[model samples]
Target: MQDFNGQIAFITGGASGAGLGQAQVFGRAGARIVIADVRAEAIETALAALAGEGITAHGIVLDIMDREAYARAADEVEQVFGAPPTLLFNTAGVNSFGPVEKTTYADFDWIVGVNLGGVINGMVTFVPRMIAAGKPGHIVTVSSMGGLQGSAIAAPYSAAKAAVVNLMESYRAGLAQYGIGVSVVCPANIKTNIAEASRLRPAQFAGSGYVENEASIASLHSIHAHGMEPIELAEHVKAAIEQNQLYVIPYPEAKEQLRRHYDEIVDAVLPMEADPEGARKRTEALRNWAADRARVFQKSEG
Candidate 1:
């Protein structure tokens, strides 16, 4: 892990933005970069940029939500690079802004599938093989500041990213026994095209009065316009990797929010009382609601 020279890095969503920035850093550190992206043209552009910088990199068209595609990408990376990649960066994600009541099930599915499920798929498809090879490796899953603390208007995004943060934490604990390192990044806001690159709602959801129209999208763009640069966030990621840190938060403001979130949770916890079954039932009901919605979406898609 200390040495990255000649190592291989497999990065999802590496066509542009933060993912591509991370690729550039890894490439500069002498690692062979395997960049997977859903956008064909963007991947080509990224590859060209890396080549111009004298970095070793290859691009593959990938949809991280597709398990078969993920597996095939891993195989292809090994075939082209002659070894399993030592680094896996699960950085693909999308953003949607609206009240939970106005967010359609499709929106939730797409966000959760790409943001959280994608990271799970990457870990499942890559981590075991890395362990099997008995080589030093690292996995970095990109969450967000919203992952640490809920956002008022981005419920689906917050839920999905929070899942990623927890998943990476669990993976870190388990992987430590196997000599693999794991890092989770919680970026507050970065200048990324995620809002623009997001897929449009299907007609069903578009007409359901739950989709974010042009105005909302534009508002989100305005916020991103004021966010940090991808390169600066990439620097934090690289530093975390070098230091073997488990959590990487690039924004100072985000650190304060995380502290506040923890304090709020502690404050909300009340002393145990008799007949707490009602509270437990309410929690279970919420869980079941989320699960039921997820199931309905999967069934419809299937």
Candidate 2:
């Protein structure tokens, strides 16, 4: 995992922003890059930029939300590269601010579809191919600091980003047997084009509860203007991948904030001292069930 030399990296949203940063960083480190994105023009631009640096890269126009298209992209990767990518970057995402209560199904479908669903599609499509290749690999997913806590203004966005963190956590253990590493990058804010995600909303998902306008999108720039640069953030991600580290939250304030947020949940738990016997019995029952399940699985495998 420490070496990315000649490794194939398939990155979604690779046309611009964070994804493009990853492409540049990883490609520079000797990884063959595949820039997968929905925008053909942007993909061309990205490929050209990578080429100017003499980085080995290919561009694939893909809508990660489309499962069939995702599968085809997977096929295209294998056909073009002669192998599945050793590194998969599920970096595409979208966000729109709206009152939590006013959030529409379309909003969830679009926001969650890209942020969460796209990650799922990438996992489903690539994990099997990566596994079958029988090569060690790494999967890095881009979540947000908003994911660690709920947000009234961007409920669905937060929820979806949160789900990706959980998703990578689960994959970490499961994929370990296959020599695959998983890392979730929960960044606070970045100088990226994500704020303009609303403009990409499709007609099928036009029933948005949030206001989508130039002014609203423009307002986000002020907030993210002082954010970290994408290439600089990508350096942190590269180090995490090499080290097989989990939970890449680089923001200094995040530790204290997450501590306060998680502390509340921890405090809400009823202490075992309150009902020692009940807790003992519940723990025993779960252990017995798990023991039996393990035996059953072993027998089946045997």
Candidate 3:
């Protein structure tokens, strides 16, 4: 929506990084901010920072992987704000890097739980409420540039983020009927602390933490420390939300990378003879199958 004035924004991972950036921008635009994060100390700091700027903000300690906790947080948001949030941000995420074969199951769980599960939990908990409110709203899920391409070292992170991209596409198609806009942000590197995500790994996943790749980790940290400012990315997100844009990519180089990746996939597909009749028959069969399986979303605006 063009107007964010008086809207309530519920942002996961809002304590820091890109989420915090969004809070800053949306708050300046007159939206009440709700910062949900697992780190209690960080939440305190973020809330204070917002308060210093005269932005109305609330903080809730949240671990997005816990579905019960998410439900409670939603209740708390409504309790505090007197209504459900209209702007939802599924931006909480973490990163880990290692050889694919060497990565442990715990690694998969930890990475997937925070990156992909966080987005799913946010959608499951908030989308229905936003729908019921029958007000214009928007959902933004932060994937990554890596999600658009594969990486040998960060396979788990890439896989989880890639799934987020696909999930948001489905939500966009379904939620459009209700006028709830959806945007999947695939941002490139930015100045954030995500490189140090291993610090918060649960005890259960300790053994699966980043392998002995200090040099690589150091290189990545250096890049992230000097990357684009969060406020710049925040500006892009604001514009995207205003325009109801589906994809938000702030980095210039990422476009070329996406092009190459998609080009490779397109080139790799096996070619067959062009047959209009055969294609029409296949299309009809697909439609029948979708109808039979109840795989299509059918909803009409009132």
Maximum-TM-score candidate? 2
Local lDDT at 109 for model 3: 92
Off by over 4 Å in 1: 200-214, 269-302
Model 1, range 1-302, lDDT digits (tens) per residue? 77889989998989888999988888998999999988899999999999999999999998888899989998998899887889989998887776777776777777777788888899999987899889888888899888877766778789989989898889988798777899999888888887774454334434332445677667778888888888788888888888889999867765666788799899888755644887789889999998999899789969
Candidate 3 regions off by >4 Å? 212-218, 270-277, 290-302
Candidate numbers sorted by lDDT from highest down: 2, 3, 1
Query: Which digits, one per residue and each the tens of the lDDT, describe model 3 over residues 125-240?
Result: 99999999999999999999989888888889999999999999999998998999999998888898887688788887767745635575687789899877877898999999
Candidate no. 3 TM-score: 0.93
Q: List the residue pairs that clash in candidate 1.
A: none
Total colliding residue pairs, candidate 2: 0
Look at candidate 3 and give me any clashing residue pairs: none
Q: What is the lDDT of residue 257 in candidate 2?
A: 86
**Model 2 misplaced stretches (Cα beyond 4 Å):** none
* Candidate with the greatest lDDT versus the true structure: 2
Task: Give each model a TM-score.
Answer: 0.85, 0.97, 0.93
Q: Which of candidates 1 and 2 is the stronger one according to lDDT?
A: 2
Better of 1 and 3 by TM-score: 3
